[model samples]
Target chain A: MAGTDHDKPLITGGPAIILVEPQLGENIGMVARAMANFGLSELRLINPRDGWPSEKARAAASKADHVIDGAVVFDTLEEAVADLNFIYATTARERDGFKPVRGPEEASRRLRTRNDAGERTGILFGRERFGLSNEEVAMADEIVTFPVNPAFASLNIAQAVLLMSYEWMKSGFGAEQTPFAGPDVMPASKEHLNGMIGHLESALDARGYFRPAAKKPKMLDNLRAVLTRPAFTLEEIKLLRGIISSLDYFSPKTPRGSGNPERKAKVDRDRHGKSGETVKDEER
Target chain B: MAGTDHDKPLITGGPAIILVEPQLGENIGMVARAMANFGLSELRLINPRDGWPSEKARAAASKADHVIDGAVVFDTLEEAVADLNFIYATTARERDGFKPVRGPEEASRRLRTRNDAGERTGILFGRERFGLSNEEVAMADEIVTFPVNPAFASLNIAQAVLLMSYEWMKSGFGAEQTPFAGPDVMPASKEHLNGMIGHLESALDARGYFRPAAKKPKMLDNLRAVLTRPAFTLEEIKLLRGIISSLDYFSPKTPRGSGNPERKAKVDRDRHGKSGETVKDEER
Candidate 1:
């Protein structure tokens, strides 16, 4: 699912999703999940091939039981869309006659507008194998077709539903309102990040990890890039620093090994007058 | 899938999708299908639970055989995302530390900008049961989490990937750029529409459908609304006109034979001022 349940009710009067003769239970469950991801609750099935109340669908739906529980089953497309003031039929192939077609994004906006204006709206999806018949499509006010690969325009039932549901959610929330993560954790300051990087650098240096000092700068930059990329928190930095400390202590050769003459001479050669002996013992 | 195979090269250097410890082949296949929907090709797997080259995954992928065929498997998350310049880990729960969390939309834009600048990028999704570990997420440049329900923040692996892939495709091609339909069919002209409406209206009038004269205008308006809503093609208009003609000819009380002459005369009186008694016979 795209969004959490409590992420502010972004959608108001969102369109109902009607699946016509959907075959597989997995697809139905996935459709329910996709709907819930986008804050869509209404699920209308027009004579689902596998029948209603399927265990496979429930299991596949994962946690979107709300959508499946409230799902309305209809005998025909006409019955399915009887209450909707506006309807959009999804189809991959162009039908026999001219119908105004809309892509998912545009259709989503229209749904929002019409829904906001107090008109009931719903999107109709066809069967998995054959799609909506011409007569079934005739009942729809607009045709919605994905700008898909012409060579392979077949979209499974759930994928089509997912695209539409995603667009609907995006239209309601405008992407900005969708949070990346909750504010329970705060980002570690730059100084803390720098300190952790220094800790790792020294640990690696002690192990002769930065050999061939000529290419050390680029290697250091790469390491820094990798370390700083995740934007570690204070706690993560502390954990990483602990890991660095463990590595330094567990290594076959430590800086303290230089207390012996022969090892100290080898360490001096490895250091090579670069950043060899700059180990800062700082605690965070 | 959102797009067909020949939707032109709309995306260049799209990001790789890495799944870590995926449990089911069905999930991997769905991820491939979702990726193919948005024109993504590169797929990297990190120690899948069901193993590689899964027959179930291939079956689930449907037409995304290309993505499945090219999937790369890695033993660890470190190796999977190593070659990529940037990586975002998808996780539902708040991990140990703070990281820059981005929604799919923003992340997708960054990915496009980086890819356009010749930087390789990829996204990491954790396992089904438990998401990426702290150590695994620590390797990512950023964290990406769906704005899912707090009570049940579980989005199946494929749905998460689908949202990200959809955002990626949408960022590359603005919603406006997505076509509604191909340009082969044109909306029927007003004259053709009017002709079809008139045909249906006269057929209904002959059947005494508008017997309540006061409501005729509203009924006619509603009829026109239904007719025009679909933006019918010329051929559709012709087909509809044919249907009207068939109904008129097959009506039990066609103008040619009045079941009750008095009632028929009254119907004639109601339809008197309007399209009185004209019918055109044509063959396509």
Candidate 2:
């Protein structure tokens, strides 16, 4: 789970991640990892520091070998993005208003839309210390900035890559579905729920737990409200009924902690009668 | 710009960030920096490896001293989140259908809503390599997972922290506004656009650019459509008119490539006549 699974299909193809003069090979590796996590496979580097074929980056990639291995290098930023139809330059610093600046989410949507239309789009990241130059920003069609605390907006290269990659993935695949789904249990039928509630009420009535007769109706209403709110599953309703049955019949005088076996058997028979067939008949 | 600004107000009091037995001090530092970037200040660490007060973490925090300095440590994850009314456990691996699982965006919204309602909430991040155990996840009210590639779902501790922090910031501040606004030039007046189109049409007419007399109207419509699509600015319209004027009157025989000076003077005079006063009068 901590490393790559070569057997599973590697999701590829999205906007190119263009790094303009990225300083550290380790940063490049982390960027590759982030890109891999979000299914962005295209990596373009414009004059990376210490040249290409970086072992440091490969090690940092943490087994995202495909991205690091497929990374393309260029002598200039223009050459790197020459074939791209649209480009976005990422920056933390404010510039003299020229290109339209978009937050990451909007920019990701635009990039995804353009990409869907068969247009090649890329986002440019700057040098490790000083972000994209003014000339570099001008080269892009638009600017994208992270919505961060303006006072401490400096995000490391990999962190920036993670945000854009995350947003790009969310834009294309949507933000609704996670890697896995939640539990898929259905709500319990009202008949089963009312049966459980009635059983509990009867037990409470025997114990005189509803207080004075004048307030019994209000207390029942409150009890019903609480029980109805959870929308419990069929299994949960059965469990509740079992608990009520145990409380109503079991005592220290019982032969064992197993409670009255006859009552338990009756409870099991009643639960079966209330399930599947009965529920379907009720629906009909 | 790379470091913290102590003089600036530190944004605090969002959901608490609870890290369970995090292995690396550098990762903790990075998490702190990511939190600071997105205005999340409260940090709760549950038994970090290598103990607390590590110099490596401080250096990695990149001067996000406020977050690192104010970080609280707990002996257990339960104790770390003892006061929180709501909790979300982050996991990369799928679990055995129990708690409700939400994607980061939805989870962020829920966290923000609970926080706004004056209820304390926290997000639980697990160890660097092993992640949170099932027992640890079972301690939370809900499961929150990233929408990452199923084949490569592993996200470093810092990256996980960054995504949660980013979504939290976006949930509160919104994604509509970037750090700065774009250029604010007004759209060109329709009268000005019409005037420029008419001048260009006249020039083309003089050159017999619309061949075949029967197609003249269609050709004129096509010309107007292309010119009208951009919604050009006032300055852009003026530049377009100037270009057209130069094309209509200039010749290789003209001295100093200045275009016919007499015609240029007339063009200037006509442009003045089509200015603010003329536009306002026409509107009336």
Best by TM-score: 2
Give the residue spans of candidate 2 off by over 4 A. Answer: A1-7, A206-208, A212-214, A242-249, A252-284, B1-8, B174-284
Q: Candidate 1, which CAPRI tier?
A: incorrect
What DockQ number belongs to candidate 1?
0.08
- The top-ranked prediction according to lDDT is 2
lDDT score at residue A89, model 2, on the 0-100 scale = 91
Question: lDDT of each structure?
Answer: 0.67, 0.72
Q: Who wins the DockQ comparison?
A: 2
Q: In candidate 1, what are the lDDT values of residues A1-284, reduced to their tens digit?
A: 23355645533248899999889998899899878776788999989888998889998897788888989998976567655656788887665443467888777877776665666778988888888876566556577877554444547878888888877876766543332232233445444555555555554555444545665665555454334333355555554443343223322322322323254344334322122333322221
Off by over 4 Å in 1: A1-13, A151-154, A174-284, B1-13, B94-98, B149-152, B174-284
**Clashes by residue pair, model 2:** none
Interface RMSD for each predicted structure: 32.5, 33.2
Cα error of candidate 1 at position B269, Å: 19
lDDT of 1 by residue, B49-99 (tens): 888899999998976888899999999877887778998888877777778
**Candidate 2, position B182, lDDT:** 24
TM-scores of chain B alone in all candidate structures, in the order given: 0.68, 0.59
